[model samples]
Target: MDRPLGPVPAHAALEALLPPTALLVPEPAPPWTAGWDERDENDGFRPDWLQVRRLVRELMPTPKSVTRERMAEAEKECGALGLDGLDGGEGDFATLWTTRTGAWLAEEIFEGLTRLCDVMDLEPRLRDFAEEYVRRGMTVEAARAFMLAQ
Candidate 1:
């Protein structure tokens, strides 16, 4: 992993500006699209509106960004798959957009997310995170969390 070093001052400056971008890759894809697995079901189920709102808010980090649209699509897929007992009432696209999120969940929206990530260039942040975790304001767990977030 080691490479040649630049002068100390330039190295420091480069580190401050950005970490190496090659290492940060999105997490592995998720499994499950639809269909109930009875073994995974629970007896009681209740929706938590507070958690729902918070979770939705978290998804819509950029006030008026495409994430909102993407979320709606993912939700639709989640509903369909979940109602059908696919996830036993719990499902998320997570990193599945790499596949389905709910693959067929929201076809257009899933495609849009790919475009959005391309337009946003998330790989750069990913790369820096891989290069050096501490410099970018993340704990070891937080670094793992970032991968999970993707």
Candidate 2:
């Protein structure tokens, strides 16, 4: 008769699927870090800047309060004034939001990227370099490539 699969067999399967250097169980948390738990308790309350950017981009194709024709007309007038497109306006919106809210989206993104770098034991200088690249009108893909090269 075939043996029934049990907890031991399941655990063995999980172990085999993981990296060879992986621990079977999590390590115990340090007592000294216990107080740091509350530090991130309010993390959920922070706005997701990535999602905000996406929403703003989507709204760009459609005027928020104006009619489509009026938006097109306004775009033509803005172009006559040397403006590129609604994207330029969205950039201004991002700047305004960051200034008003006391939280810059790019700074938050940089912080998250640096934290990930820390976890991977990689150099943190990429964050500042990326900021400079973006400031110089480099695309995000270009910035990422520059960072990865570092």
Candidate 3:
């Protein structure tokens, strides 16, 4: 089959690689409305970022050549985006729910996720899920509900 030529939607890309049951315990969808709230005021960093990384490894249908250690290393390198002090406009909050500390669902994270789909030959699946995800407006709340309802 021919491969998709460009980046896939982030959440769909992630869902395609994770186990079907990953949503059994869905992370609390961060409230994007709370734009630029301080991390200390809101709480600590959001776990959804790292949580996705963990799920990708834990829920693989088959263990590919990639090792857990390698995944960890990937996390170390791309994991923490000093999400503290992102001085972007409120409109930026539309896609990312960031804290005053600056941590958020950045594009780089999604890029990494979609790249994983390409490596795993899951781009077709990602495409399907991406369509659904887009239909739901690409909101985390909708993604959680859709995954759970499945």
Task: Give the distance in Å from residue 25's predicted Cα in candidate 3 to where it truly belongs.
Answer: 3.0
Tens-digit lDDT string for candidate 1 (94-141)? 332222221122222223333444344344544343335434322333
What TM-score goes with each of the models?
0.20, 0.21, 0.24
For candidate 3, write residues 30-112 as lDDT tens digits. 44433343353457644444444344335332224345554444334433643221122233221222111111132233334
lDDT of 2 by residue, 60-140 (tens): 532233344444554455556554433333554333322312122222333445345434544444445564534433233
* Per-residue error (Å), model 1, residue 117: 27
Q: Each candidate: RMSD to true structure?
A: 14.8, 19.8, 13.5
Q: Which 10-residue window in model 1 sums to the lowest lDDT? A: 98-107
Q: Is candidate 2 or candidate 3 better by TM-score?
A: 3
Task: Give per-residue lDDT, candidate 3, residue 19.
Answer: 31
